[model samples]
Target: MERPELPLAQLHAFVVLAEELHFGRAATHLGIAQPPLSQQIRRLETKVGHALFSREPGRVTLTSAGRELLPAARQALTGLADGLAAAREAGSGRAGRLRIGFAASLALTVLPGLLRTFRERFPAVRLDIQEMTTTPQLAALRERTIDIGLLREPPAHDTDLAFETVLTEPFVAVLPTTHPLAAQRVVRVEQLADSPFVLLPRAVGPPLYDRITSLCTGAGFTPRVTQHAVEWQTVCALVETGLGVSLAPASIRRIRLKGVAFRRIAPDTARTRVAAAWREKDPSPLIPHLLAALDHDPSDGPRG
Candidate 1:
């Protein structure tokens, strides 16, 4: 059989009266008239089906029933208080989970510093980080699988999503260490016109791929296609084999392949931009806090 529900007011009065052992004093502590205090204790005792206090002219004390209920009542009140505090913290964006998606290449640049800043400011919030390419990151944000995204070359027109540019870096040339252009301090856009080009497929990242090809076109030639790789690391590795030359964000220099060299592109006008993206109409308090963290300057320290 299920037990009956006892009102919190009765339980509170019972505990105070038990502690004080005097109706006058308990009523004073609870800031009520003595009659109401007595009535509350009576209601509680009736609910428990027992007389809770033994009343004598000069003395009052707990019956066995009241003694048994005191500890449980105190525990219930404490639990409720704790639960309320946790709810408040979650509502304030100081606690709960924040899922983020980021491009693989960003790990070499702004990802770490942005995370460190957010973690420091909201230490109790749990971070769920996923490494994905630009396209996958966008899809995850739309599907609500991720709360924030750090990606490169955000789409120009996406009404469902909003983006903020966090970093913009110039393109650099990646070539075989033995290549003649590698010996020079910088490579011009036209320098690699006739060279076999190792580039990412447009399907993988349209904007970034178009930027590279546009740079070549602006220099009066279309790059001779030779190889395609989905990842920058793979692209650089292919270049290392002397299969072709490639252009990548300056941050790609962090990849340490002994057979490859990274050189600045002269005129340096072509730059890849990384942005933080999120759904425009979704209301998540954690998203705003993360956006604030992104406002801090990204770390420019030496790459690993």
Candidate 2:
């Protein structure tokens, strides 16, 4: 059954009159004349289908029905006020969940600070971070499964998505501590051309994978691939076991696994770039707070 829409004005008048037990004073409290207040009480009784007041020789009091409804009527007004407040919060983007997608490389360095600042600035906003590769991050953004993505540069096929570069750092040579080249303070790209390489699969992020391979080609030889891995950490793990030397973003240096040594390339050949991306048309108010929290004049920091 449909609930009746209670008369809000009548409820206000009835409650005041019940407290004062005098029509004139109740009307004064309500900022109205006594006749109008009295009429509202009569109207309220009609809606409730019960006589809500009793009069006896200059004495006024609530009948049994009015006493029963007094508490419930106040509760209804309180609920209405609360519901309106909740709706306002939702509309203002001051409260809501933001699903953020990020590259695994960020976990060791940038991700922690980004998260910490975001929490401090917007304590009420919720965050759900997903570790995804650049390719998958782009897909998730398009599919709307994730609200925003922080990863490598996306494919240049769409103009509707906005990509903002946040960090750009040089790639470093990752080698097992036992490697002969580990003796050198700086390893040239050409120096590692002969060593079998541990490579991240192209599927993980073709642009980054291709860039790594091209660094070897630029040094006058194609890299000899001895192992294929998915995550950059996995590539580093294989290099740690002496499978081969791998090249990775400088940020990977922050991931300290035993038996791994990071070496710089002469003049810093290929740079790893990090960017935050979202649809150009996305109008989430949460975006401003996020961008503000992460805001900084990015120095040429050596990280992924």
Candidate 3:
């Protein structure tokens, strides 16, 4: 037997009429005239192949089939409403995860405050963070492994990616508190030229590392790199243990590592630039919101 597929409008009319049981009341509840409300009930009965209402003199009651249909109609409407809400949330980027790739050097200097702000504004977004270098992060972005990257300066020209500067802090010398140069409020790069330098390998990022080396060379000395660490924190850790002095962004001062002193370098020797990059024309809605969060000053910390 071919049964008529139920329509939501008719089911709604059936439910409202069933609950009220009076044509006048049901019509008012549905914001319709009594004649139309009664006609809709008749249409629903015809479609269901069952007389849903027992018409009597001055009163009405539900039949067996109508009673059974009531709960199913309400449950279906509730499910539909919940489904629409979930769809809206996902479309607005309020639900779903964002994969972020960042250079290890920035993990301590710039990432914490940036992430805290992003979370406060979009609590439902899941942040999947990965520690990667500038060069690799480029490949990650191209390969679609990560949605955004926090990295040092990229090549001068690239059409496949877009980057925005997040922080451009001058280089600061991280020295052991006991080091003679640490006694000064600010020390020039030339002063540390003769000292054993602790630095991350140039492979980590040629732009920043080259800037550091070029400064030493311009200061008339080739830095004797005595130690190499993958992250800025590790360099400070090495400095704390009296291993060797290292150059880092001024933001590294916030680390407050015991036994390490951070001092500003000479004017214009080297600088550390941090930028957030993503696919040039990404379709994902999460990128813009993430970029806005990254645009703030980390020194200010998360907004109120």
Candidate 4:
């Protein structure tokens, strides 16, 4: 036998009527006239090929078949309602997990404040943060392992990645307090050209390491690099021990090493451009929320 298609609206009406157990009240609850509500339930029962109710003209009673199907019908309606609500929330960007990658330096400079603000505004959002080097950060972004990255600059190879400048930090020279140059208020990059330095690993990013070396070259000599560290803290520790002088972003000032003094470099030969990066093709709902939290001003030029 060919079965008739069930009407979803009529099924809803039948469930409401079954719960109410009164024709006139169920009609009111459905926001319709009693006759139409009764007609819809009759149509639903016909589709089901069974009597669903015992009608006493004034009172309604669910039949054995209606009782058997009622729970399933209610469960379906509940599931549908929950799904719609979730869709609405997601459409508005009100809920979801955001995986963010950041360099160790930003963890000291801007990340703390940004996260505090983000948490206060969107408490329901789950933020997963990972510390990664600039090179690994771009790779993670490209592989979709991270939704966004707080990095010094966008990768040169990943043209598909978009970058928004968050902060332009000037370079500062770090020296041990007892070092001879530490007494000077401002030291030129050329003045430090002859001094031994602890430098970032060349593999961290060629352009970045080159930028530091280029600044020393512009000052009329090549840098005397002594040690290559993967992270800024390691370089800072080396400087504190009087092993070598090093140049770092202004955010490094926040690190309070007892023997280290952070001084502004004269002529300002180098600066770090911190930017928020993400794949251009990826469409994550958390993008706007994270971008808003960054509060980056497009007009802020690179630090001199």
Local distance difference test scores for all models: 0.87, 0.83, 0.82, 0.83
Residue-level lDDT of model 4, residues 1-304, one tens digit each, is 7857666688799899888999888899989998999799888888788999997766678999999879978887888898898777766777777899998988787888888888888887789999987888888888999989988855555667888878777888899998888999888888897789998887775667877787888889988888888989888898988899998887888888899999999887467788888888855787888888777523333432
Error of 4 at 249 (Å): 0.3
Question: What C-alpha lDDT does candidate 1 achieve relative to the native structure?
Answer: 0.87
- What is the Å distance of residue 133 in model 4 from its true position? 1.8
> TM-score of model 4 relative to the true fold?
0.80
Off by over 4 Å in 2: 5-76, 296-304
Candidate with best lDDT: 1
Residue pair clashes in candidate 1: none
lDDT per residue, candidate 3, 77-117, as tens digits?
A: 78888889877876888867889998876766668877889
Name the regions of candidate 4 deviating beyond 4 angstroms: 1-11, 22-58, 63-76, 156-158, 296-304
Pairs of residues at least 3 apart in sequence or in different chains that clash in candidate 3: none
Q: By summed lDDT, which 10 consecutive residues of candidate 1 come out lowest?
A: 295-304
> What is the C-alpha local distance difference test score of candidate 4?
0.83
Q: Write the residue-wise lDDT of candidate 1 on 148-206 in tens digits.
A: 89888999999999888787888999999999999999899899888899998888788
Q: Please give the lDDT score at residue 125 for candidate 2.
A: 81
Q: How do all the candidates rank in terms of lDDT, highest first?
A: 1, 2, 4, 3
Provide the global lDDT of candidate 3 against the true structure. 0.82
RMSD of candidate 1 to true structure, Å: 3.7
